[model samples]
Target: MRTQVRVVSRWIGDEQGVTSIEYALLAAMFSVAVLGSVVTLKGSLGDAYEAVATAVTLAVTTAMALVS
Candidate 1:
């Protein structure tokens, strides 16, 4: 019974495993934040690209008309 108690106490005192777990949790949280940002910005980025494409198409059409 004393040996079992000692082992448990020693395990509880050891912090290496705890530190690793904390780092893993931190990384997971950072990954979640990055993924959320990307998802939220996806629609905005798509809309901006579409707007730029439309403007370029219009400019090209206007230039071609002037040339003709």
Candidate 2:
């Protein structure tokens, strides 16, 4: 009974795994932030690409009409 109690006390006071748990939590938080940024940037980049495509199409149509 005494040995069991001593083991339990030692386990409760152990700090060996604390740093790994903290690092895991920090990594999860950083990943969430990065994912959020990427999602936002994805939408903005799509919009920019669409605008450029529309501009190019307009210019090509105008040039073709002039040629015809």
Segments in model 2 whose C-alpha atoms lie over 4 Å from true places: 45-68
Model 2 C-alpha lDDT per residue in residues 46-65, reported as the tens digit of each score: 99999999999999999999
Q: Which stretches of candidate 1 lie over 4 Å from their true place?
A: 1-6, 50-68
Q: Under the 3 Å rule for N, CA and C atoms, how many clashes does model 2 have?
A: 0
Clashes of each: 0, 0
TM per prediction: 0.58, 0.54
- List per-prediction Cα lDDT, in the order shown: 0.99, 0.96
User: In candidate 1, what are the lDDT values of residues 1-68, reduced to their tens digit?
Assistant: 99999999999999999999999999999999999999999999999999999999999999999999
Which candidate should be chosen as best, given TM-score against the real structure? 1
